[model samples]
Target: MTAVTLTADRRRGLQRRIRWIVTATIAYNVLEAVVAITAGSIASSGALIAFGLDSTIEVLSAAAVAWQFTRRDPERWEKPTLRVIAIAFFALAVYVIATSLLALIGRVEAEHSTLGIIVTAMSVVIMPFLSLAERRTGRELGSATAVADSKQTLICTCLSAAVLAGLLLNSLLGWWWADAVAGLVIAGFAVREGIEAWRGDACATSVGMILEGDDHGI
Candidate 1:
């Protein structure tokens, strides 16, 4: 972070990297939403449905960052773009918490969904890599919006893991409550991230000071 300064040429390269990374993220989440929603509907799994909805929000958040990076002066739009990503995180937190609570109250026992299991498992493997790439690029470029979006992606990875664990528990045993509980936990994570994004749009010494920081080496 300290060593690599974002000169004009380096800035362009990092922006391009962010675009490509977000594009791939968008594509994968679109497919994930379709599969998870379909599988959740068939299996009557509220957690899976919430997961799908979260994917759709991820698409929107990533799309915001993608759009921001396309701006002629991307750094100029950092605050607003990060606000958008933060709102998305808050929205996801609210929705997941509601769904999880309802599922718990109803004691909803969903049918075994091989599709749900497979899709969530796939996300668990795929999402962290994308998140890490975007985060590193964002930090180097001093782009708050891009970094916020990466955290959102990381949250999705956590959600994927929670859902996968819940599905496995339900499938192997009869612990249908597992996914709902996990969703509640992930919702808390989302809220915490949302707060970070909201207050952190203007990172101390990072904004407008590309690649001039400590060598924490993130």
Candidate 2:
């Protein structure tokens, strides 16, 4: 095959892989959100609640990617699709910050959550590799949407780490406030990432797309 043909084939394969990953991530996030919420409520763990909200945001981001991929013309859809995802991220950040603040003011103390800790540990183990693979494929294919989705996965990995640490400290040290503190930290990181995604900084790799052209016509 010619170089152009090879590139085209690679793009197709990457897109297919991304689609599958997005679908699985969405499904997993939905289940994760439900479980996180239930576990958080039972344990009164702020970190778990924040983690659940973050998963919900990931679901929204995945939906946006699915929509973008389905478009007949991805280039034409790119800017507007990214804008939609950004808006969703911004809104989620606002909600998370507001609720976290309210909880802090109310002096809420979190209980021990074995289930939340277990789930968070699992996410920490799983998400980083998946995100790195998606990001590598996205760089090869020059798919901004896929890259943005990968960033979301990266954020989830970070959030899982923070949640696990907070839960562990609170459970073992009797530091009831650590979970709420962790939620604040997670919210800060999420807000920063959300703003970056909303402003298009996260998906600004159009240079690759430009070089490759479209439909293997390079």
Candidate 3:
């Protein structure tokens, strides 16, 4: 009984930490979206605009995670939360692909965007830490929603790197098409992750038997 009590306490502590991390993610993404969209519009850079939209999707994913944990039965919220995240991912992919295709075919030129560069660089630095923390805690807690959210964060990190590289190449090498290419790569990644999240295979369900009744639903 004592061991069981201690284990439950630890789980509660971890869940609280995961909640805090998701909250921080949502806050940062909100700021990032505003800054990136503003800077992208100013620079007329499609890649930067897409990056900003990706931040919005990140906000949605994090919000879903937050909503799940706030429920009386967090496990019961898992399927819906995953569906929301998957939809966000698919939306991200569609937007990015469309933007990239337009930029590529139209021969659209992207101007140097120092602000976009700075914001994406910061995201690349910050998101990894958030992802690692949540992933570790979520796995320990047997919370698939938390782990899925962490994956979403990690995907954003990858998008950050792609967007940063594109901005740097355009600014330094005058490779205007680099941004479009990077957007395509980001689209591919988003699609893959979206499938995984939709399948609810973002993490194993071996712990806690939480997924035993997953298909039947509450």
List per-prediction Cα lDDT, in the order shown. 0.88, 0.72, 0.83
Which of 1 and 3 is ahead in lDDT?
1
Ranking by TM-score: 1, 3, 2
Summarize candidate 1's per-residue lDDT along 1-218 as a digit string, tens digits.
Answer: 34445567667788898999999999999999999999999998888898999999999999999999899999888888888989999999999889988989999888899999999999999999999998877877788888889899999999999999999999899898998899989999999889988887534346767665433333
Off by over 4 Å in 2: 1-6, 207-218
Tell me the tens digit of each residue's lDDT in model 2 across 67-103. Answer: 7777765656666666766766666557666666766
TM-score, one value per model: 0.93, 0.84, 0.90
The predictions' CA RMSDs to the true structure, in order, are: 2.6, 4.2, 5.6
Instruction: State in Å the error of residue 184, model 1.
Output: 1.1
Candidate 3 local accuracy as lDDT? 0.83
Tally clashes: model 1.
0
lDDT of 3 by residue, 150-169 (tens): 98899889888988988898
Candidate 3 runs further than 4 Å off: 1-6, 207-218
lDDT of 1: 0.88
Evaluate candidate 2 by giving its C-alpha RMSD to the native, one decimal.
4.2
